[model samples]
Target: MDGKRALYYAAIGIAVLIGVSIVVSVVSALLSLAWAIVSGIVSLAVLAGVVYVLYKTGAWLLGGDDADYSASDSVGGSRSASASTDAAAESRQDRLRRQYVEGQISEAEFERRIASELETEEPDDVDRKVADIEQELERER
Candidate 1:
């Protein structure tokens, strides 16, 4: 009986030691991961700053396209770019609406995603595109 009791206490102590080691290992790993993520972000930010500075310097040296960069003023070029971009965005929204209607996505998620998509573009253009989609939906119904 005395030997059995000693063995049981030893087993419990071993288990406690193992548990503490595991916990310590997990904490260290998490800290390392966090440090790595922060370091990576700082590095990327510094690289981006360097690239931007170099681009600005090069642009200045080349007499920056302020004079002949009027490509956006072209009749078809800018209009086509705008129209295609709007169409792609409208299609994405339409797919999201369909997913919501089909119960594949929650209304809240749909609203959040759509709002994020619209936020990237001009408010008036987004509004007009949304109105056009609404009209098309009404016609379908």
Candidate 2:
């Protein structure tokens, strides 16, 4: 199931558990000690069960290779992926291009930077161009 459906089910389950607990507490208060103890135990068990169900269901809904999500791994993996996507470089290039257009850099300097970027061995010349542009823009500012 999707996240929204999971949330809806969780809300309903929580409401029902709370309602039962309230009813149990009220009934216990009206009963003898022995009965009150039994009622309290039952209420606790039910609440625990509800919590376990929610935990399991949530885990199932959020699909991943492993049940355990490592904080560092998730953060690092996405960060690396994004770094390779060229977004970072493109943003930089746009700024540099703007600077060049605004006469912050002489045409020869701009061409030189572009040429150097094109000659980079990184295999992602587009990204390098963007990075170069961004560098120029940042320097201009």
Candidate 3:
């Protein structure tokens, strides 16, 4: 009778030990999964922040107002012909200035282009030449 009682107690102890081990394993797995989810979210948030910063920096560096003006100007075509011509000339000058500032063209080349742009008396000729120059620049790019 004594031996049987001892065996019963040993069996119960083994069962309890197995139960505790299983509980610990399950809790550890859950914690690991939670950590992985948190890490993923943090990584995504960091990536989004970097992209936002880059976008804002680019807009600031490239002149946000210029982009806005071009968009609005293209959408609204109600300006007078003379005003449009003057705007076109100003746009061309701005482009040339940007190119020069960026070192895409030498000072002499920039000056020559500006002079050629200014020498055109007729609006039609100016438009045609400007189109040609734009095409050439695009090809170079």
Q: For this target, which candidate reaches the highest lDDT against the unseen true structure? A: 3
> Model 3 over residues 80-135: C-alpha lDDT tens digits?
44545577675877688678768899867986987787686477656655564555
Candidate 2 local lDDT, 28-115, one digit each (tens)? 8778787878989999999999998888767655633333432322212222443345553434444456567788987668767666
Best-to-worst ranking by TM-score = 3, 1, 2
Candidate 2 Cα outliers beyond 4 Å, as residue runs: 1-84, 121-141
RMSD of 2: 22.9
- Candidate 1: residue 91 lDDT (0-100): 60
How many clashes (backbone N, Cα, C below 3 Å) per candidate?
0, 3, 0
What lDDT score is found at residue 110 in candidate 2? 74
Task: Return the TM-score for candidate 3, rounded to 2 decimals.
Answer: 0.44
Residue by residue across 1-141, what tens digits does model 1's lDDT show?
A: 999999999999999999999999999999999999999999999999999888877765553533222233211123235645565574677578778667798767876888788888887767765565455445545
List runs of model 1 lying over 4 Å from the truth: 66-141
Q: Which residue window of length 10 is worst by lDDT in model 3?
A: 70-79
Q: Alpha carbon lDDT of residue 110, candidate 3? A: 80
Compared with the true structure, the alpha-carbon lDDT of candidate 3 equals 0.69
Pairs clashing in candidate 1?
none
